[model samples]
Target: MKKTIFLFAILLFISCKKEETKNESLYPEAEKSAEEKQLELGQAIFEGKGNCFSCHKPDQKIIGPSIQEIAVMYKEKNGDMVAFLKGKAEPIVDPSQYEVMKTNFAITKNLPEEELKALEAYFYSFAK
Candidate 1:
């Protein structure tokens, strides 16, 4: 009887651990889905209301540095690009053209926090 109970308890503990592991795996998938959704929203805003494409391109410089360039610069600084968007942080990528960006910040600074975060995610996605 003692042997049987010990075996049963060990089996129960193993099963509970397996379930916990399964739950841990699920969390990242859900988080990835949310991040993807945010990226989609950011892309829409960049191409639409943000008017970002007017001055910036994905891989090459236009009136401003490329999106990839901005991503690399921000990642290097470990910077808060969202705060930069909100006009709370200074430009780290291209201070020489900050005057041009200042006009654009007038629009970006007004964006809601969710949109700003989404935009930052979208920009970071360009980094290599």
Candidate 2:
């Protein structure tokens, strides 16, 4: 009887531990702050539909300037990032690459206002 009880106790502990871990992993998005959620959405767009990752990286230059560089350049311009994404503003970080970016504007210019804001917020978050 004692051995059975010990085994049951061990099983219960294992079950509870598994449940705890499962819950932690299951609802990670629910636990994220608003900024985190925005960043996640922005990242998804950047990597998925926006296709910005093809030419712009978070920290390094590729075919275009890095996200960090754009963020810093626009941080003082007040809404210029959103304007650029919306095709309302000209490229300021690297005008030499503007043609490449302009060709991609069709993809970004039509984004929903909320997504544009979120993408801007995400880029600005990287500014230093």
TM-score of each predicted structure versus truth: 0.74, 0.74
Which residue pairs in candidate 2 have backbone atoms (N, alpha carbon, C) closer than 3 angstroms, thus clashing?
A: none
| Count of backbone collisions in candidate 2 | 0
What is candidate 1's CA lDDT for residue 35? Answer: 79
How far does residue 53 in candidate 2 sit from its true spot (Å)?
Answer: 0.4
**What lDDT does each candidate get?**
0.91, 0.86
Q: Candidate 1 lDDT, tens digit per residue, 2-51?
A: 99999999999999999888778856656467879999899999999999
Give the clash count for each candidate.
0, 0
Best by lDDT: 1
Cand. 2 Cα-lDDT: 0.86
- Winner by TM-score: 2
Clashing residue pairs in candidate 1, if any? none
CA shift of 79, model 2, Å: 4.7
| Model 2: worst 10 consecutive residues (lDDT sum) | 75-84
Question: After TM-score superposition, what is the CA distance of residue 58 in candidate 2 from its true location, in Å?
Answer: 1.3
